[model samples]
Target: MLSKAFPRRMTVFVLVMLLVEFLDEFTFGVTETAWPFIRNELDLNYAQIGLLIGIPLFLANFIEPIFGLLADTPRRRLVMVGGGIMYGVALLWVASSQSYAMMMLALILLMPASGAFIGTAQASLMDHEPDRHDQNMARWTFAGSVGMVIGPLALGAFLLIGSGWRPLLVLIGGLMMLAAFIVWRLPANAALRSHASDADDAGEPEYGLMDNARLALGALKRPAIWRWLILLQFSDLMLDVLFSYLALYFVDVVGVGEAQAGLAVAVWSSVGLLGDFLLIPLLERIQGLAYLRISVVAELILYPAFLLVDDITLKLVILGIIGLFNAGWYAILSGKLYSALPGQSGIALTLGNVGGLFGSLIPALVGIVASHYGLQAAMWVMLAGPVVLFIGLPWRTDKPIKLEESAAK
Candidate 1:
């Protein structure tokens, strides 16, 4: 039973998980919520502002797989700790920046720092308990939802108190520092230590940076993996496009105030807590990938409904449903991918992040299209994602790659 397996250790794990999620969500929320104020202060336009928002995601996605490969080594802990410290320092830099160029530079540095910790944490979670991948990942997802719920409200409240962007930036940096501290204190589980010692004893070939690239490229060669990648990309694009623009959409298109729209986005995100908690266990009882396919199809059908609806009540309800579908997809899909690449969770998840990174780029294109075409037209373009997913459907369960459990034993 999970209760019997490291009661104290599990508690620490959960706490650290929550801390990481909190820091990640808080950084995103503070940056997003503070955007208008920053734009006004710096006299930046939509294109420049979009670059500021999208650049970190672009860079982070690229670096995550590389970080994931490094996590396979004993040096994972050092990378994680250093990354967390760098992330905190970057946020502090962002908070103190006086000019647009300075803030942009800070954002570029922030991306890799954040990716390091984020990449290592997921790999660590799976490494700590390979058998409990789904349950632990569900918990991780839950923590992320909580962070998403808290972050926007905290930023909004900070802004309301006339604290300006500095306070929000400092708050994120402080949370990241707290996260680094928690991660630093976590004891290396027996499995990880054993893996390290075995590698040292056996004199396994050390993978250099080029070898890491080759491994990632080799994983991508499998067709089933690419199918999963495409599905993940589409889902990520849908989520990013909605999230990146939802505030503006609520204010301009839906005729709501900024505060109310922000609250709505928060509510939209908060509902994900329920989805993660409830959907993961239920889907685990069934086949994970099968459930994911259904959920993805449902999301495709529901997301475009946002374009047709105008009533705030209906829109909120639709958004809530969308959140449910969206949250379930990540929890289920990540679990499925992790299971598929049992020995290579770090590399696989990182590649998945890479797919998400490419997906993140879609919103920038969406924004460009939306500028010329209607927002509805841009959304319609997103609809093609689901259609593609439906067409590129996998026929059978991808066989799980067996790993040496005794190495863990």
Candidate 2:
């Protein structure tokens, strides 16, 4: 029943979904770049700033499973469009917030919207090209890497002109709305409604909240799943948590100008973009887990060096290399995890979010430590992340659980 042009349409659909991912991470990247200014303007303490950053992810722990369930339903396109629009509105709310409580509230709304868009988009990608999970994920993350690079630069341009954070927020909001509109106008088949109907006819089970919960629990029971979840937690702590605070660290500790600090953040992302671009070729030759192991070990060496070095330029160079090695980790782990749970991609991703629940606490904990001992000391906490990742990753490769075989139970 599919048209001859379905492959082209699917490619276009994936590009649109990548744009959605771009907008989401771009917003977060802008937020990270703007954090120091926001902190100064609002007189926020480290703990409050941490709360601003961490609470949304903490809430997403619960919210992701709900969206994950929606991804399994016929309303997937609605979820993607509606969630993208809500995220845009939430960014406007963030722009208008005058208090820490208001900022936190805006972020809380932002997280679920993001979760809805992300869960559905990933599901749609897998649904369209079931055999190409690794390649598709690489493409997905590559788009996000490009966004992360551009986001800070865009914000930096605004900062250079003295337009400040509010205008940047407004700009990101507008982009998200535009992304939503594009998704809404996609054709019925592009939205994969026919695929959903076919699966329903084929007797694939409909997942209510209880069904989602059961699947999530079953996912948790698998050792491979939990190990990968733990690996994701540590990986996020190392890369994302570190990134969110990097600009602040540069401004507060390294005595850099604010715009320069934003540039530092941009450099990290730019190198990551390069690394992701290079990853496409490497993936063709290397196994995902093997690549992950090598990358993690490299981070073990470079992360400490970046933290300990006193020269600003040298440190920035080290950060760039760190981003290079950090490139394929999420794609690999995600591809492997999804492979282990073929039909249950939503639950698999939700289980990763469950790990994110605890991982989200690291920012707040680091904030508390920074408040007392300084950010330099707070950064030392990051050492544990890679160590945990290296130890916890399923290195042996023989233990992957086949969730599709037992998902009914």
Candidate 3:
């Protein structure tokens, strides 16, 4: 009875989980746009910016595994709830920061908090529909894309209102606090009867923290897990690493001001929003890996053209196309990681964090290149993302069964 009524019983559970992704990306969207302004106010240079971004990510890889281990425990709610509170607090700390060190300290705190809150929700979502990992990830990515669209636009709006990134972050932080309260208010009753109550999300945990950690680390030995994990990091060069540098590139190299730079980021994210929305349905008709083969090729061409274009308007157009091509990159790649480690989404999250420890340095590396050779020179490094994807992706993998065929059965 509970299994049959699960979706009905736990609609709120799914919604809350998706909302966490939204807030996480929303923070990114705003912060990514605010970087140029943040640099201006703080008088920061590229190397300093690199450290500000890299060190936190380096440390968070160590911290996030702890939370991933906690995801299946009796304390899952407390962990998530506390993570949400800290998420808000960390953002507020950024808003209050007066020095580069203070802001850096806040981001270091923010990353792990995000890993705990958002990572737990993502793992639960993957566990919720173990059989439809790609499909569910598409849905999750769509939710996040909406926030990505809202993020820069919200920052732009704040700038228009004589407020700025700091005030906008304050608003985003307050919303996180509200999200935490709602997380707290949900009663752990029959509500988790379906999607939420599945052993992945709400059942009594089967392993202690150390046991879970051991299992998660053990899974890393599988080539299947390593393949997706490595690809995930490499692909991110064009996805996130590219996005992080975009505003600065626009400001310094493209001859644009902060407002226009925000617009460029908005255009990138809005097209990504469209792509994410379209991908949810597209996944039904084609294999996720099949889609990746096509999209990666397209991005290989588009990303280079984006950097070479002399006109900002043409650059925006190219960026939108690149965003479109890369829409399902994270969704499909991560879904594969979960599939590779079946029944272990929490472990998959840990694996991703571990993998991230290396990729996290990519931005700082890019920043160093930009500082030495200039931002335009550094932009070319992003091309490595697609080049590796073209080489590393297995031409033949995934079960022979098509998703549409699986659905019919």
Model 2: how far is 202 from its true place, Å? 8.7
Tell me the tens digit of each residue's lDDT in model 3 across 1-409: 8888668424777788789899889999999888888998999999899888888998999999888777755556677778899999999999999899899999999989988878887887776666788988998999999998999888888888899989889988999888878877776732122224544444434556887777776676566678888899999998888889888999899988877888888888999999999998899899988899999999988988888879878989999899999999999999988887665666678889999999999999998998999988999999998898899898766443322233245
Tens digit of per-residue lDDT, candidate 1, span 161-186: 87776877887788787788777777
Question: What is the descending TM-score order?
Answer: 2, 3, 1
Candidate 3 residue pairs in clash (backbone atoms < 3 Å):
6-194
The worst-scoring run of ten residues by lDDT in candidate 3 lies at 399-408
User: Can you give the TM-score per candidate against the true fold?
Assistant: 0.87, 0.92, 0.91
The lDDT ranking, best first, is 3, 2, 1
lDDT against the true structure, each candidate: 0.70, 0.80, 0.83
lDDT by residue for model 2 (16-69), tens: 878887877788788888898899888898888888888887987787777776
* Per-model root-mean-square deviation over C-alphas: 3.9, 2.9, 5.0
How many times do residue backbones clash in model 3?
Answer: 1
Local error of candidate 1 at residue 121 (angstroms): 0.3
Model 2 / residue 254 / CA error / Å: 1.5
